[model samples]
Target: MKHLVILGAGTSGTMMVNHLIGKLPKKEWKITIVDQYKTHYYQPGFLFLPFDIYTTQQVKKDGRKFIPKEANYIQKKIELILPKENLVKLEGGEELPYDILIVATGTNIAPDEIEGMDGPGWYKDIFDFYTYQGAKALRNKLREWEGGKLVVHITEMPIKCPIAPLEFVFLADSYFKNKGMRDSVDITFVTPLSGAFTKPKATKALHYLLEEKNITEITDFNIERVDYENKKIVDYADTEVEYDLLVTVPTNMGDALLERSEMGDELNHIPTNKATLQTLDHENIFAIGDATNLPTSKAGSVAHFEAEILTENILHYIKGEPLKEEFDGHANCFIETGNGKALLIDFNYTHEPVEGTFPFPGVGPLQLLKESRANHMGKMAFKWVYWNMLLKGTHIPFVSANMSTKGKHFEKMES
Candidate 1:
């Protein structure tokens, strides 16, 4: 029997297993997924945890529960990957040989990368919401704390869910308003980007929203270090911003195991073909999700789209057929604004977000690049879809892996 080994039983790996189990012949191909974690987290829920929108119990589950019985699930920490030998070594004296390997080991936060970030103020005055424990900790801190200087920050770019810091500040605005302490708290959004977001049109829209909410926008601020004792963060240019409470998104990097194998980039992310989702070095090895150093957003929607393309390509590779390079960096994000309203943005590699209807050209239950109550409901309803349809490998209706321009209004770009 041919062995197919998948590392990291997270979102992408779990979806790949479920999608390929029935498609790939069980007798001929043995599917196995390996990871160190016993619990699976709905990472998107982490953003809501600080705001009390989601409880911790709703976000975690047994990792084995989502994995299919048809696939072998191994809960072990990976020590190294001997790609030349086509084997994965566990922490103990065990090795699993594979005919084909899939790398899905996701990204992690590196707060220690910044000096004084994890210093005296760590988990006390300085907090992060990117991790499960961090988000829960911030919730506790927010509960007992009175309002003060709340600085929401991003250490660097290319973080998972890039707009989450903005969302955090927006939700914080609403949270404090409801608590009747909106005037007592001052929120500031700090980022390394030149604008509120990466794309031009989305940035314009988001910048307006930030101004409307009276949340100060501090752009192009490259952080040098956190001055914990002084209750301030300093940039490389000697600029400083003090905070009574700091909720920061730390620098994100791919799994360290990739660096150990010398198969990844400086950030430990695997070099993969952007469209094909296959590793650049080895033909039989593929990468997906936050593990790949693709120029696309490191988001769940991007991973979901990549998995669909990768599944088809894997079958093509086994049959010795040509693999399709059809992935267009398709990504869709729901931006939560305040007051029971949210906004949606859908775009790809060459397109920026525009005001239009989604899925349907003329009429939409969800609007693109515009705030609406419908969009908020769609955002809330996605939690259900994520747990039920998405992880189970069930195809989402009306949503395809590719981007569509049917309803989007694009302005003519000058050469």
Candidate 2:
């Protein structure tokens, strides 16, 4: 039997395995999935943890529950990938040979990459909501604190859920106002980008919301180091932003195993064909999610979209057929804009987020580029969809992997 090995049973890997289970005959192929952790996190829930909207218990599930019975689930850390030999080494020195390899190891936040970011003030005066531990610690910190200078900072770009930092600041504004401490707290959004968001139209809309909520924006600031003792962050240009509490999104990088194996780019992301999701160097290996160096938002939705195309490409590869170059960097996100309201944006590689209704042009229950209570409800309802449908490899109706311009209105924003 030909062996198929998948690394990191996260969203992409889990979905891909499930998709392959139905397509690949059990008699002809054997599938194996490897991951160190057994518990899978609803990563998007991490964004709401700091505000007490979600608890640690609400976002976790057994990883084995989603992996199909036909696939062998090995709970172990990967040591290296020897692509030339078609073999993967595990932590205990066991080598697994595979006819095909899939890498969905995903990216992680590296707070240690930044000086003093995780020093004396870590989980105390400074914290991040990227991980469960950090999010829970921040929750505790926010509970007892009367407010002061609260700064939400991003160290670099290409972070998973790129819009989450902005959402955090927006939620914080509403959280402080609800606690009757709006005037006592000062919120500032410090980003390396020139605007509130990467897309021009969405940036204009989100920047307006930041202004409306009285949040300060410090743009184009590249971080040098964190002066934890002084309760300040210093940029490369020597500009300092002081804070009583700092919510930082650190430098994000792919699995260190990729770097050790010398199979990844400078940031340790697998070099991939932008259109096909195939690793540029190896025909037998493919990558998806944040693991690949795709010029797209490293969000769960993007992974879901990429899986639709990558699964088809994998099947084509197995059949000795020409692979379809169909992935278009399709990504959509719901921006939580406080006070029971949110906004959604849908776009792809060639188009910026435009104004329109989602799923349907004139009859959407969810609006795009505009804030509404319905959008917030849709965002909240997504958690249920994620657990019951997305991970199960079930197709979500009306949401195609390819971006549709049918419902989108292409128009310039009023800057």
Task: Identify the leading candidate in terms of lDDT.
Answer: 2
Q: Candidate 2 local accuracy as lDDT?
A: 0.93
Give candidate 2 regions above 4 Å deviation.
411-415
What's each prediction's TM-score? 0.98, 0.98
Model 2 lDDT tens row, 1-415: 9999999999999999988898997899999999999999999999898889988888899989999987999999999999989999998899999999999999988999999998999998999999889998999999999989999999998899999999999999999999999999999999999999999889999999999999999999999999998999999999999999999999999999999999988778999999999899999999999899998999989999999899999999999999999999999889999999999999888888988888887888788999999999989999999999988888899999998888778853343
TM-score of 2: 0.98
Hey, what RMSD does candidate 1 come out at?
Answer: 1.1
State the weakest 10-residue window (summed lDDT) of model 2: 406-415
* lDDT, model 1: 0.91
